[model samples]
Target: MLAILYVSHGSRVAEGVRQANHFLKQCMDQINVPIQQICYLELVRPDIQEGISRCIKHGADCVIVQPILLLSAGHDKRDIPDEIEKARAVYPNVRFIYGRPFGVDDSIIDILVERIHEKHSGSVQNDSILIVGRGSSDLETPRAFSRICAMLAKRGISPVSVCYMAAAKPLLKEGLELAVEQGPGKVYIVPYLLFSGILMRTIRKSIETSVNRFSFVLCKPLGYHPSLIHLLRKRIRESIDYDRLSAQS
Candidate 1:
């Protein structure tokens, strides 16, 4: 049997975890695979190892490992691969196919527009857009973020900029400070996160303490969207013959 295992960046916030679970379940329902399981990389129970065990118990001979992330960052390139390699050692007979994360997509950008418009739908001519991302050490991470900024600009959303929460340049505080100082444009703070959690609270707290607290508007994080389901389905299809191996080997 073929099973699909989704590994998401788990959260310490119970509500965040719940949202992740609910989103993945909805994604699973759309995929035709017989057995599908969801697990977290950290801060939650039933980690990657246990998720695979459950898949095996369900009689899965082949498991497609899908990453539920926004970027191809440390987790995608290292942590998840390390865990999957360990699983390969234990389940030598099972075929493992690793899938990709939802990289830059226009549909996602559309959703971002939705998020941006949700807070302040007024004229953006003099207004600026600030994208707050959960930064990653991976070199590709910022490049991808920059592309998002450019795409936003292409859509005529000008004067857009980005800041990171960790592991990258222009930390959120500095970004917020700069946004407060620059060009007299109201900065629309768009969190480039998947779900709501600690970071969301942190963003709120930072804004409250920042200079000209009312000068900024916070938009929703990129959360449960139908396009993500379509993205996952597309990625899973791409892993059709990826990393195939005979279980008996």
Candidate 2:
């Protein structure tokens, strides 16, 4: 039997855990093979250590650590792998495979395009889009945002720009201001968040109260999308394939 650990960036916000768990369950239910356990990395209940132990107890002969991050950065590239190393040591008999982050994949782009169409089907007046993300000091974070911008462009709507909520600039509000200056009658503030939480609510509030309130439309965060599950499964399979090739070598 195989165990899959879906790791996420820890958040102090309670809703963050709920969102991840919800999606984990949804994906696990759909997968043909069983998922032995699901766990978090930090800032929430049942950390990675606890999760790994549960997998071992559940008869997981092999473990796959699937990061729920969008890009390879500090957490995806470094921290998560380090933790997996520690987990592997504790569960010596268990073969562990670490998967890639969900980067600028086609499935994700499809989801984003669907979101844009759903939000503005009736009113997509060449409106400027402001793709918002939880900014990271990691360079890949902004690059991910840019990739999304290019994806949107393929659907006939290039974003006015990408902005961060916390780390990089222009901040969400500043991005909105820029959209206003661009003279678009409507501006969509699309959150590149995985879930709805306090920060998302705050973003909505800010958009509602902005000086250009009349032109802004708020889209929901990405949640429980099947496309996301496909992305995860692909990464898991890729990791398995890579490990197999390494063994043969």
CA lDDT, every model vs. true structure = 0.88, 0.78
For model 2, the superposed segments whose C-alpha errors exceed 4 Å read: 10-16, 122-125
Compose the digit string of candidate 1's lDDT tens values, residues 99-161. 999999897899888898898677788888999999988899889988998998888787888
- Which residue pairs collide, candidate 2? none
Clashing pairs in 1: 93-247
Scored by Cα lDDT, where does model 2 land? 0.78
lDDT for 120 (candidate 2): 80
Candidate of highest TM-score: 1
Give one digit per residue, the lDDT tens place, for model 2 in 10-91. Answer: 6778777777778778777766656546777777767888888888788888778888887677888778888888987887
* Angstrom error at residue 69, model 1: 0.8
